[model samples]
Target: MKKPMRLSTVAFFMILAGVAALGVAWWTQHKLGIMPCELCLWERWPWRVLIVLGVMVPVLPARVGRGVLWLCAPVLLVAEGLAICHVGVEWKWWPSPFPACHAAHVVGRTLAERWASMPLMPSKPCDAPTYLIPGLPVSMAVMGGVFACVVFVTLCVGMVRSKKIRRF
Candidate 1:
């Protein structure tokens, strides 16, 4: 018989994958000099959820953990979609949000005005790619595709394993 997959083992690998993905994102930003746009940063929130779930599920009971993994499916799918879209936007495949991506300089009349307006304006936009390799045309989002794939694959694997375990 095939060895039963341990919840802890799956969770551990998932967490490790998430961490590695995050590390790659950071490293790509720093080494490649790609700057993240506002939406790019926003998209990361879902990935953060995956990472958290990956670690937390191992601690929960088998039933609860499986449920959590199931829940993670949609979240991972959405995150992947967002990352893919972001990459497309970076490549000009689709129109990005209006007003352009990235922070704009506000010439406020006074220091207080500038401070007050800061709350109203985001530091970055969806159109602007924060980081790009010095010579390469590819943006950070392009590099991030790998991370999305990782999440997608992990979610798929978890689902398959869960089904197999339940059948037994």
Candidate 2:
């Protein structure tokens, strides 16, 4: 295959790896019926962006696509940082800023009205330790870290390969 085509294939695999990771998270949640906290949703933003970049790199212009791939570095870094912090909070290594993951439960006689007044809440805490892989020492956040590292490595490799191919 041509260099661009090969690079595109690698990009597709990177995105698929991300999707598979998320899928495992979702499947774990489904089987266990666990929900993500508000902060957890926030943790997803970077991965979501990576997923988009993975899809776009193959289809978009080279310059724009390269820029997007480069952009993923910092994004994943921050997200990984947030996930690490979140895991720390869950492990009691630190206190989470958002003490409440889900919305506060309604109280008072007007419970129905209170419920009605409750604001729309996110799926999970941005720092909630919801990863329950039996016998495993790692949480979802840790797994996210692993994925980010893999993606960064893959992106770097792709960049190098593309540069070499361009020169040839």
All models: lDDT? 0.68, 0.70
> What tens digits encode model 2's per-residue C-alpha lDDT throughout 1-168?
555435566567668766876777677668777777655656777767778878888778877777777776787687778777777877778766775664466655787887776656534655456546678878877777777777777777776676535343
Best by lDDT: 2
Error of 2 at 101 (Å): 1.7
Which ranges in model 2 have alpha carbons more than 4 Å from their true place?
A: 1-5, 102-106, 109-128, 165-168
Candidate 1 segments exceeding 4 Å error: 29-34, 98-138, 162-168
| Predicted structure 2: lDDT | 0.70
Q: Please provide, for model 1 over 1-168, each residue's C-alpha lDDT reduced to its tens digit, 9 standing for 90 to 100.
A: 556566666677667766776676687658765555666666767767778988788778888987887667787677777778887776678876534364565668999877866646344556566554577776566656656677668667756665544553
